[model samples]
Target chain A: MIVTVTPNPSVDEIYWVDRLKIGKETQEEYLTRATDSDISAGGKGINISIFLARMGLENIAMGFVGGYTGHVVVRALRDEGVTTNFVWMGSGETRINLTVLEHGREHIPILIDGPGIAVAEGEMNRFMRRYRRMLKVADWVVLAGSLPPQVNLAFYYELAKLAKQAGVKVAISAGASCLTHCLPAAPNIVKPDTREHLSFEWMKLGTKEEIISAGKRIVQDGVEIMIVSHEVTGDIVITRDSIWEINARVQTTQFRNLVGADDALLGGVIYQIYNGAGIEQALRFGLAAGIVSAESREKVCRDMGKIEREMANVTLNRI
Target chain B: MKVGEIMTRDVTSVEKDIPVKELIFILDSAKMSNMPVVDEEGKLIAFISEKDIIKAALPGYFEMLHSTSFIPDMNQFAKKLGQIADDPVERHMHSDVICVEVDDDDLQAADLIIRKNLKSLPVIDAERRLVGVVKRIDLLHHLL
Candidate 1:
């Protein structure tokens, strides 16, 4: 079974409007009706858990939740058949992130930051105890997403270390210091979260060569697989023996929603790997799943036939 | 209204193998009087409640009847609690659980709760996976 840890889970509220206009200088009251709307449990690891569950995989999502928003997150996951093991914080509610998508400009989404969470020491201890117990039965443990405020920067490092000791494969998807501190644990898979920035530590990920070099450095540092995003439609996968570039043939205009596409890609790869697929095949399937998710209205596409068809559009080349 | 519309979606559940001590802690922390027990695949299998814990701690009906002047004491309750704290919840959970499907009419859940004197009814999907729960209060609120 796979176990996903989302330190700061959120209830994502997405609205698709015909047009969105921000009034900067003029002060006027304007109303815009949403053509479509949806709310779901979100956070990198939570999305991965939902994606895996959609494929009929046994996975558990662990995190901290509180108040009414937290209840929404749990309820949504339960409805999707994702088992959850969340620690209810003593104070404060779980954050809610809002995304506004304009009808014609679906590629450019307006993202809103959610409230930061402050996890108490007691809550951290409770989460650790539950996490340790879950590690015993987990074959793969994904420590993803950003750290909550007041949480130690080495939180993922500690979790990866524990999972390693339990003989479970660890996959880390994080950014900034959270990712930097956990590299020592040598997680099996490392996908640098590039939403906030395009750099991993000192290495700039502006060009293909830079991304490939950075990926190789990470792989040499003990990560079995390092997947670095080279562009919106491509990723560089570097292992000890091989380096491959995975490219999706689909155009940006074909994407209806790119909110959870990255998570879907990671989830697809993990699912394939868990089912005994080789890294190349897994990456191919993963890219296909990501393309399917991006082109559909759903955050993560679960249609196996569609993903299989999309696989024909994914091309992998040795770097 | 459909049961899915009125049911409480945020229902807390547990597996059958959960320790009684952990079960009690969940019950107390969640402020839930009862919890549905599901299998690994999320199939509803049994139900455990505060009443069941109390029944386990107290003397049985036969024992009470046999002794005319039997009195319950803290020591007896404590000893019984200790004995069962580490035991799996399946030993005390009621296997015959009354439930409603998510697509069923809300009145069906209300009827079951009222007729069975139950606090809530576990709502399941077509595949019998525990999805949500319909409580006595939820029905009453929907009535208004």
Candidate 2:
């Protein structure tokens, strides 16, 4: 079973409008809210966890939560039938992330990074112990997305190391510091988008070839797979033996928004892996789902039948 | 029965001289299984399938592979890109064609497409210069 751990989580609030104005109050004429709205559950790993649950994978989401906002996140996960175990801090409210869309363009204009949860050393130790125990049982562990400040970059690396020791496959999606540091540790997969790639000084040249070469360099550092994502160019996967390019399937389906495609793709990969598909198949299934998510925006994952059919249409012949 | 009602006027067709990569991108963007290849004079020359692009761009065309993590090796993926590319539309295009005039009955066009399980049929003027192509899906939608 796949297990995802997010150090930070927030409620994702998406607002759709005809046009968005700066420094002006906007009225909601027609607003649609998701079934669950926990602002504190808005991290990459959390997104993937919810998607895995939707895909019918038996998985657990472990993280830290606090206050009323944290409670909302936990409640939503439970309602969604996602087995969640979040370490509760005695202080602070979880943050809320607001996504505003206008004229088919969506922007995360405001993200309230929730108040920091104060955890005593003992409490942190307890959470880590439990997290380590979970790692023991995890077939695949996804250390997802950004962390709230005060969380150490090495924290996820520790988890990855422990997961490796337990013979569990690990996937990490994080910022440059974390991704850069974790490369030597050799997580199975590392997802770094264009912005994250910008921090790599070696990529100053900024050609597609340079960017992919940098990714290949990261793979040489021991990462089994390097998922380098760019907005216009789509996402590319670099492995020791192969370099595959999957263009986002934007034109095929009518687009609603483009927020959760990455998380949805991660979930697809986890789901296919749980179903015993090979790495190649798992990646394809993940990309197919991701493409659908891009089209379905607001909708978390694509309809499974549509995903499968799209996957079928995507023929991946090696060169 | 109206052929105009069922024919697609804003259809996307590739020039015979277009690169295979551009053709693949168009087919992908259009979400179409096949596209009508046309010459500079906008005359139908060939039809290219997704399968054909995949085979041309990818080596080892016979091996059974899964959908995910499938990356075609770019170095080995030599596609004769433009004019001199080995897989030109003229060399590979199906020139033997079933076609219809714009004045033909829509039902007749639909019947021919359904019977043949064709994706599209070239529409011609009295002089047979390309005008529009009737698509199977468009015909089926009219029936609905």
Which candidate number maximizes TM-score?
A: 1
Q: How do all models score by TM-score?
A: 0.75, 0.61
Backbone collisions counted per model = 0, 10
The residue-level lDDT of candidate 1 at A140 comes to 97
Q: Chain B TM-score of model 1, please?
A: 0.91
Top DockQ model: 1
Model 2's interface RMSD:
26.5
lDDT score for residue A174 of model 1: 86
DockQ of each: 0.09, 0.01
Q: Name the 10 consecutive residues with the lowest summed lDDT in model 2 chain B.
A: B79-88
True contacts kept of 1: 0.00
Task: Supply candidate 2's per-residue lDDT for A247.
Answer: 59
Question: What value does DockQ give for candidate 1?
Answer: 0.09
Which stretches in model 2 have alpha-carbon errors above 4 Å? A23-40, A107-120, A193-197, A201-206, A297-299, A312-319, B1-144
Candidate 1 ranges beyond 4 A from true positions: A23-26, B1-31, B34-144
Give the per-residue Cα lDDT of candidate 2 at A198.
57
Q: Can you write out model 2's per-residue Cα lDDT over A120-190, one digit (the tens) per residue?
A: 56446646755765664579999987776576778888888888888999999877767777776789888
Error of 2 at A114 (Å): 5.2
What fraction of correct interface contacts does each candidate retain? 0.00, 0.00
